[model samples]
Target: MKKLSLLILITVLTFSCGNKKSKSESEPENITQVNPAENYSGTASITQGIATTITEDIYTCDRGRKTDVGEISSTDGKTWIVPAKTHYLNNDFPFATDLHNSCEGLNYDTAEEALANFNAANTITIDNDGETYTAYIFADNYFEMYVNGEPVGKDKVPFTQFNSSVVKFKVKKPFTIAMKLVDWEEHLGVGCEENRGKSFHAGDGGLVAVIKDAQNNIVSSTNDTWKAQTFYTAPIEDLSCVSEEGNYRYSKNCSTEGGQDGANFYALHWETPTDWMATDFDDSNWPNATTFTNKTIGVDNKPAYTNFTSIFDDPEQDAKFIWSTNVILDNEVLLRYTVE
Candidate 1:
């Protein structure tokens, strides 16, 4: 089954949401900036002047959103990675709420150091010829272009809004993409209005890219997913089952098994460990449906995995199950994956 996958599209940056507009100072300086263009060895070349490339490939909190990957290239045709972060400078700001600084991850101290660190990081390889063209990159807030070792482009600042600031870069051949991150708040100013004194948590940040030709014809694109360092813990649900004539398994649908209209379902195939048995299995001890709580529940994405287990009696025995999001109450269980 094709489940709705997560995306890292939006930026963790501050937002201008809500009806009441907060009177902020003239938008602060763009702490983010891309250096001059240089030569590189890939497919496209920086024939004229410098070609600075900006991308939003950082991680974010919002999942399943669309993002952009700016088009840029170097003189040698080599692909260069852009570095980004939440806050470029070390400026302390208030959080959105009175609780802990909602902004969890921000501030990449010392721009040069952060840039150098990013440059030294591994290079991303993008290969596509048939249908799917894909590239991988890890950025924070914004991206700066560089070729071979020289840099390029104007001091490009990524947008603070969720899905803004999607620039394009020109590429043709296979090349290495290196990148770094910056803390945008350093120049933008964090939580100035209502969040005064409230600690703002650093937002999830990263990169965004789209496949397009030199003439600006879009080919394909990648979506966004959670970018912050937070972890996701999946919960488990139980669905008891009855065996058929000679078989020891059964199948049922989720809606028929007590699932509600707004109920979020996740199906997983579980097998009893070799040491355990369906007869010896204690439903109270293992994960159950009630284990899932604090839900933003609704039917959206499909379950990541689904199956059954009969292994408790014999690990080597072949245990099978028909997986599905439509679960049977007494047939199988659903796992609730939560973010920590």
Candidate 2:
């Protein structure tokens, strides 16, 4: 009887130890898994067993092939593309000559608008007062951004159906933000009239940007409150009517010597302020920027942009269009902004 009791006790203890071991083996251990999509647009976060986040960079351009400049990545946590260079001049004599000769070496208010045709650039100085901020910028054709006179970022493509760029920077007290915007034209001076019968052949130009602080507070944005000026205007000569009754009536090569109808297409010539980008420059004379609502065409095509609504938070600020009297005719315009 004593031997049997001892055996029973030993068996019970063994069973209890086995049950504990099984429980320990079956229990789930803390593990983290991250799976990112192939074409990730922005950052994504996930918190599973141990809380983890995964992110990737991706960019797509007109060609659809992954070129070095079109790559969007986050390997070093700072990934961006500089705007591609587009050919704005052709073999045209007077226009091309004047552009290359007169516009060279001039310190344009905006880097993109330095060329006297179809481009505009401007700078804005902000007193961040020791704060961190992020900027969202986009243009019709292309744009490059600078912070404290340092090139921080630029748009990926020179021209597209539509696109935008985002950048972040930290500054103390006072900082400078400069941008170069270009309105690209395929045929130099409005496409040849021979190709298409469209009256308005000139391309449109616009630049809209917004800045926010680390706390997600709005600091600055493109609006009438900003100061703006014109740096370049192009295709000033009006097309002369060579023949009255033919498909080839208009001639872009006609001379503007005689006092003809629409002889002067109202070209604007101005000297760029030497210190326009400086904080102490006087912008009192500069006109307040004129704000125009984005045309219906851009908004209808939703898939072409990323977070269009978020960047353009205000319905009123949506697709803010900046131009002269006409989009095509007044192709180049310089805009300036100062933050107090």
Candidate 3:
């Protein structure tokens, strides 16, 4: 009986040891391992100490609307994965209360004239204390901005449903800011309006902008303080004529060539300025910019603009006509501003 008990105890001890060893050996060598940095197969670059990687090709409109029109890989988790059919606005951002137009009234002398005034450009100049400044601008069609004759940037999107642009640059005490605005015309001759004839639609134009210093103080904006001049004018002539298409009647005779009339017709009545965008350009004779209130559109929809009073005092005057006397015949306008 003693021998049997000893044998059983020995057998139990061996089984326990075997089970412990098996359990220990079955455990993983390491429970956690660090993942290696992903090897991205895309364009990578460092600019201004900021690293940017573009994993997939992006298509952008001339005005800077970005769309992912290329293949996206799921193999690398680092790639920015956008859902299928995603649309991106300029700079991959959204804005509010930026939509403004000078021709919302459409009661101007002619549709072309309304569009031209809306297309007019203004240059605003404000003295800076040698500090960094930022600017935000938006136009009906489009605008190109320059600081001291150095191109800063232009409107990302041109035409209706306006998009705003932001630019930052260092400035001296007194600097010149110039902008060229254009009311994009589908037909070089006729403006963009709805249902003139076949595709004869004429569109209006306008521009509003604001600038701030490093302290975030308002320095400049689109207002009466800026000077403006029309460098291009078209379509609206003193003479009136009917189009062969009979889709719409013209307030001016756009029949430059026989059969090439109506929407396809174009005529220029103004001359462009020579190097008007230069800092030294003399605009002493230019008229002050007319203040127009964007009553049709407000901050509720266009939040990008903050200084409503700079354009108009009364919100009820929205969509009211504000333009120079020559707006009816001018197509292209040059604006000048010198920092005081």
Candidate 4:
């Protein structure tokens, strides 16, 4: 009898231990997944991340791919373009150039109007603060220009050449801009210091001012395309703000492991203009918004970790939503939970 009682007690304790072990292993202890219930736009608020100095000594693989000029990044230059040696003498290059000899400041209603309207054909201004400017329509032979109305440099410079004299110049409050543009044959043997590696065709040749700032900084620039190269055009959009084109959205998750319901929550926001609606909003498209474990599986087949989805609907705006995960918060940082 004593042996049997001892055996029974042992069996009971063993089963209890087994049950406890099974329960502990059935649920994950440290991992939680969340799904935001909101739709966010491209112009969402961005907080500054951790700051660190960049140097050539720290050669990280990812950072090495991007062009680095001083501390500024070429990939991040929405306001500037890559520095090139040669540029267009005519208004053919996009809306980037601010000066050039080929631009005519004529066809104005008055002299005051003439000063206001720099480029005659295009709606562009070359010398904005200049008091007096000259323009000439010429055909054939070569080209050149001199500041303050006289040429200190060589004349009849061929279209195949580029002039370094066409640089940024700012003198006092008001100034005079004089330019003489000529067109001619392809091989005039004229040379330019900047156009050593560059080539130009006779038909496309024209005068263009390379755009730069007062500090000699290249604001907007482009170089000649290779003979074998192809060109594609992209429409301009605002950089400081995000575009509402396509289905644009952002998301994040917040969860806990020891809550009463054993789950967490999330928030979502987006713009739903009359034309663009979030009715067709697809959450599965979001890479990070998936549930951890499918509840369709029975408990015995389920993984130790299971996450629930929480979504948010807008209060003021019709196109906003907030989402979150439903996970029991254990003895963790649940009290400090907050949404961004």
Best by lDDT: 3
Q: What ranges in model 1 sit over 4 Å off?
A: 1-140, 147-155, 158-163, 166-172, 183-197, 215-340
User: TM-scores for all candidates?
Assistant: 0.22, 0.49, 0.49, 0.18
RMSD of each: 30.7, 26.3, 23.1, 28.2
Global fold similarity of model 1 (TM-score): 0.22
Question: What does the lDDT read for residue 175 in candidate 4?
Answer: 25
Model 4 TM-score relative to the real fold: 0.18
**Taking the tens digit of each residue's C-alpha lDDT, what string does model 3 give over 1-340?**
9999999999999989877856567867867662211221112210111112332333234433222222222223322221111223344222221233322322232222322443112222233345777665655545666777766665544443444545666777577877766655444333323333444333445666666676766667667767776443333322233121221112233322222234323332223455777889887767677665565333335433433333322343222322332333333455667766
Question: Quick one: RMSD of model 4?
Answer: 28.2
Error of 2 at 21 (Å): 99
| lDDT for position 337 in model 4 | 8
Better of 1 and 3 by TM-score: 3
Residue-level lDDT of model 4, residues 21-115, one tens digit each, is: 56566867776552121222343222111112232221112211211111212112222111111112333332211121222222222223323
Question: In order, how many clashes per candidate?
Answer: 85, 7, 22, 42
Q: Order of candidates by lDDT, top first?
A: 3, 2, 1, 4
Q: Which ranges in model 3 have alpha carbons more than 4 Å from their true place?
A: 1-129, 195-198, 237-266, 296-329
Question: lDDT of each model, Cα atoms only?
Answer: 0.23, 0.43, 0.45, 0.22
